[model samples]
Target: MTSLWQHARRPATRDDDSWSVAGNVYYGTGRPIDGMERPFSPEFEAKVRHAYKSNGPVFALMTVRQMLFSEARFQFRQMRNGRPGELFGTADLALLETPWPGGTTGNLLSRMIQFADLEGSAYVTNYNPGRLKMLRPDWVTIITGSEEEPSLASEAIDSELLGYMYDPPTGSEPWFLLPEQVAHFAPIPDPEFQFRGMSWITPVIREIVGDTAATRHKLKFFENGATPQVVVSLDPSVTPEKVKKFQALMDSDHRGVDTAYKTLYLGGGADVTVVGKDLHQLDFKATQGAGETRLAAAAGVPSVVVGFSEGLAGSSLNAGNYSSSRRRLADGTMRPLWREAAGSLAQIVNVPAGADLWYDDRDIAWLREDQHDAAEIQGLQSRTIRTLVDAGYEPETVVAAVAAEDYSLLKHSGLYSVQLQKPGTGSGAPSPTPPTTDPEVP
Candidate 1:
């Protein structure tokens, strides 16, 4: 097997401004110039990072990264007849466990999930032995091309994934890496682009903006003396200077939380009119909680899992509902992510023949509730194998058939068990007791 560093050493040659060799294909020759460098939008990535740090709901959703990083380990799994078989470890597994000098698999996974979630894609490259580097998603560009000169009309179908280009913002020359040397993980693909991925946050950007605005509004309410807007009306006879003086006094004495509930001494002919509603009157929790739920939905995590207000209220915290929510997140979201991560990282790992890199989630505490279901399924499969073996089927074929859930794979052994055979029909059986009865009659 070729090492990742060995593949990285063979950088694609750039022929000219218009054409370049990326992996096995000439990237710029037939591809559109505008589509040549496909980089994740930096502005969007920045916005996601900001929201993750500043917003409550987004931050809560990001906590899923910890669970993902902690729950699973990578190993080689044998594939037999389209079914996963035994899982085994090898020297290559060490690379994932200790990707760098001090990095563990969790560290690598956390970074992968963070970048993938925030930027819609993550790239992992191995330029040195026993060390892996994660590229900034927005800085790395995907390079695609065609094996043959594609026509303008057939480019979409003829185009193939070539590799990636890592162009840093420090004005250094870009590094070109073959596809096998870099693991490109984009769990969510962008519908607009052929190879680009789309961020889950993209769909709920409006919701995030609304939620942020609501938070700011709450802060401002407290800043303004924790009171609703008040319009001070002075009589027509009052002088402008007096009105200005009164406004200044109010701002100085009672305009902030520090001065909240202070006595207000209004001059004669002054009328105070309250405008707008307080936080309670606005039902702040319901408003912000709805947006939080929407954001969680987009994150593929149930609101209950994130401890959002909407999820915590009512019966969402009930044992059954909570378990279901956990199951949804584990099975529907994290499992798929782990699978994709394994497949992508397979590019850098040395996998044995008939074996694929897979995540071992059996030890994940988050999914321990699923153990009962797994055991039940195993019991059923064991019983099926036993029945099939006793019914004249080959033992090996019976096991394979039961495992694959395809009884057609079972082969007959042309023999039957004692229970399934006719009485006294075997070669070892006594000749029918008729001889003894005939001797007695004679």
Candidate 2:
């Protein structure tokens, strides 16, 4: 594998003289002047990774990403009459199931979603050996393009995508990929650009930074012993030099975790005065909890779901609100993401005309409540069909109309059952009135 720096020194197409800068200044090879990777560097990846490792909210965000990609299952359907016609399998099935030679569908999708959520967009190139299969996501720096044509006059279009420049991480010679050979997935797309998505992490970065700072503060506080105090004395006989020496001795003997609570030996009328406040006094618990809660909220996860102690013992634990929060997390946060990713995949996979890619959330245990609701609704629909059929309507028509929501199936044969009396006709008792008239006459 050739290094990115080496790849940049290779020949470039068009006016891509942007690599004239120092090799270290270039993020990766094959990038254009206006490419999104222009600002990216190895250092940026490290920074994001550090935040991921140190921040609580980033962990929650990643949890959401994993659940969305793994739990939501994608399927293909055929289109008919401007609607989804039927379920059918295509070459896309095999391709998606084994996106890479070694990867499963779930792994591929999960990786793509994670990268997109973190980096704003994910790019994958389709490699066909014998068939149109095999996919590999490229790092942002490894792929570059210029927006020669905007989809809208104001925004770039996919058709305008000239080509993809791929610089392998192994330091291989750089190569150019035609636009047709690659698939770009962007969830929150940039309105002004065609190739990039807006990162969800960008908005909550400050919250993440704050959480990291708080964690580090707590660690340092505990490492220096679980107490905060300042010792002062009113010993006029003691010189300032003696006080400085005493402070040094105190730090060495009692300030560390191992030396915490060790007895301090003082002499020459030196008095120890506790001046610093404890962690509780500084509202450490509140600040940390509040930061986690804010981060969870930004990630669309209720704090309780992410195991945050804040509000877990209070109203957030109530069954109703907790269930509602779970539902909101699934519907409001995750489902839309699933839909977006499925849509992007449809572009890569050969979806049958009229059929679109859809997700199967029915099997996900986290959303079993929705399945229960669906069962109850199904029961109601069955009752509707029975009632309609008993009302002299054709059973087939009733079922079809109810199932398809097509009122045209409600065209009923104007006929009554033997049990139901015919319209505009009297009851078949002939004349019970005749006997009463005879009695009146007598």
Q: State the displacement of the C-alpha of residue 17, model 2, in Å, after optimal TM-score superposition.
A: 26
TM-score list, all predictions: 0.86, 0.76
Number of backbone-clashing residue pairs for each candidate, in the order shown: 0, 12
Off by over 4 Å in 2: 1-39, 42-44, 85-91, 129-138, 141-159, 168-171, 191-194, 231-245, 387-442
Residue 157's lDDT in candidate 1: 61
| Pairs that clash in candidate 1 | none
In candidate 2, position 368 carries an lDDT of 84
Model 2: how far residue 357 lies from native, Å = 1.2
1-442 in candidate 1: lDDT tens per residue? 1332233223333324221111112211112332243543434444554578777888879877556655689999988777787799999899899988899898889988888887778889887777899998866666555544322212456666667778776777678788888988889987655666667876776687788788888989889878878998999998999888889999989998999888889889999899879878999899999999989889999999888899999999999999999989998999999999999999999899999999999888888899999999999989888888888899998887777667778899888788756788853667567534566575
Which number leads on lDDT? 1
Tens digit per residue, CA lDDT, model 2, 1-442: 1333343354332322222111223222222333333224342363356556556667666766676667766788655434443355666677777776677767766777776766667666665642333223333332333244211212334333445555546766556666566666677864434456656665655566677777777777778766776565848988889888988887788776788877778776878777777778888778878877777776667777777879587788888988988888888878887888777776666677667887767778888888878999999999998777767688877876776666566756565554676543534435434434566576
Which ten residues in a row are the worst by lDDT in model 1?
19-28
